[model samples]
Target: MATSMRATINIARGMDGAIAEILLGAVKGQNLAAERLLALSAAEAPLDSNSGGTLIASGTVVPAAAVGDDSLVTYDTPYAARWHEDQELVDNLGRHYMGDSNFQNGRKSHYLVDPARENKAELIAIVAAGVKRG
Candidate 1:
């Protein structure tokens, strides 16, 4: 036996255009925030701590504009970068290296969160500016 379920739902009529406009504005705001974060994170990331600079250099902000979602700014780096950002590790020689020990124990450089927090007001302003312009 096989079973399937389907449902139809209705939102208020004539809301499509309004909803699309709101979504576009939100996306624009998100893109602006991503741009700011990219710049701030790159500038603030600890460069001198890494031997090769790959960790700081790999920092990136994937703008929500490309993904069409406000929450989709993907701050990313290579897999090994996590150890550089947040962990104390032992090398083959049994030497311990502290990764960003100056900050919180679990966080290093905070390339993403710190910038977002520091620029919260500016991010809000970007949204407001977009709304006003629209």
Candidate 2:
């Protein structure tokens, strides 16, 4: 039997979804804008007390292969990609929208939802939803 596991990553406007998928290993890295990975934003699906989601912000993503335990890696990009807390950038961007008063008031906006193979699969689905602000 064939089974599938999914890993998701969200992308916001102005964020390169293709490049993001590549960095996450959801897609391959070929002819990408920069040799270095750029940051992206994650967001929640709906704005409600019970609704939950996340957004990814633009930042540097080192290839998993380049990481060696606690060893350091080098990145070269136009925008300096600083070291960020693990998955913290995603959480932070989500908070930026969810925590805003105007967003909570039902204003409409958009968020990107990306789906891919859970463990390691190429080809991803990037869907953008028109959401009410918040």
The lDDT per prediction is 0.62, 0.27
- Cα lDDT tens digits for candidate 2, 87-128: 223354455322223344432223221211221132112211
- Residue-wise lDDT of candidate 1 within 16-123, one digit each (tens)? 877677767777777776777767666655444446455556655556653245543443455434543567778799998776556432334556677779888998
| Native-referenced Cα lDDT, model 2 | 0.27
- When summed lDDT is taken over every stretch of 10 residues in candidate 1, the lowest stretch is 66-75
Report how far off residue 17 is in candidate 1 (Å). Answer: 1.8
The top-ranked prediction according to lDDT is 1
Backbone clashes per model, in order? 0, 14
The per-prediction CA RMSD against the true structure, in angstroms, equals 12.0, 20.2
- For model 1 the TM-score comes to 0.58
Which residue segments of model 2 deviate by more than 4 Å?
1-58, 66-98, 101-134
**Model 1, 12: alpha-carbon shift in Å?**
8.3
